[model samples]
Target: MKRPFFVVIVTVLLFIFACNQSVKVEVVTESSMRDSTQLVFWKNLGDLYGKAFRGTVVAGGDGDTTFAGELVMHVRLVEEGVIKVPFIVGRDSSRTWIFTLESDGLMLNHDHRHPDGTESESNMYGGKTTNFGTAECQVFPVDQATVNILPTRTTNVWWVELVPGSHFTYNLRRVNTDRFFSVRFDLTQEIETPGVPWGW
Candidate 1:
């Protein structure tokens, strides 16, 4: 009876150990699958560091003259988990698109500043990715911060598209409206880096 009991105990322990190992493997695989697309997108954008590209308004700038002038985007600053691209529209260098990697996914913020390095009222208003987007594109719907700052823009959804060695595009659309904006940058040709953006 004692021998049988010992055998049963050993069998149960081995089963429990196998179950735990299986669970751990499953968890790791699930996490990798979830973040694979985001990781690829992050790396693709990061590869553009230190390069500057000239852009043109491809769509929906008729109502807003803010993008009328020459458009240039400098992939100026890239850190471990952050990438800053300053968007220069004509002589204005007050806007920077900041991309940050978060635990869940990615976040985008528009850092607007005055010439004197003062933060504008609408600074840091952007959104986070809600899903695992494709490796070439990630969409960010307006977050609560944006709604609080600009109530009318609560339905805005912004996305960035990248094609390595080809082109990159920034786009925005309102959920139920006709509002749309797109700017495409030529990645094939590298331009001279622009000056420092306002408020860095």
Candidate 2:
């Protein structure tokens, strides 16, 4: 039996539409999954707001004595899409790690300042996440601004790891070089919140 041409056309159109809808759904689901992971990561980090933890340099500080003093990280500020953590070494309170949420992914910026609340020359150098990292960790490679500030550090990559109620770590690596640093903080212990970071 020969089907009507109009009926055949209608069936073909419906099939095409269904396939298109399926594809669209798949794309949306994949994107939503990625976003969910990132949000979980952000929330895990934000959970530490207003808390301070003691840290120790666990790797790659052979020649650098800057971390020899008592190290502390105060997750002092948390705002919509932003987190500010001040890294204190002994009496120095000039460095803060700033995390900002962007459309694509998270951004990590190093905020350095003088004792008198003035910005340092090497401030605001960091990068953004290049992929959908897990809820426990995200990596940021050197960004354009960082390259402009420190041309020789074009290969720098930094990653932050957070394990709820366990530990938080800040790490750095100069890709292909021997330069690397890692500081791990115990999240189980909360310390006295330090003073506001310089140039806050």
TM-score of each: 0.83, 0.85
Return the lDDT, model 1, position 43.
Answer: 91
Each candidate's number of clashing pairs is 0, 0
lDDT of 2 by residue, 1-200 (tens): 99999999999999999888834334556568666778898998888889999999999888788887999999999999899999999999999999998878999999999999999988899999998789889999999999998999999999999999999999999999999999999999998999878888
The residue-by-residue lDDT of candidate 1 on 1-200, one tens digit each, is 36688898999999999888844344556467556788888998998889999999999988789897889999888899999999999889999999999889899999999999999977899999998888889999999989998999999999999988999999999999999999999999999888888887
The residue pairs that clash in candidate 1, if any, are none
What is the Å distance of residue 2 in model 1 from its true position? 53
Query: Which ranges in model 1 have alpha carbons more than 4 Å from their true place?
Result: 1-29
Q: Model 1 Cα displacement at 94 (Å)?
A: 0.6
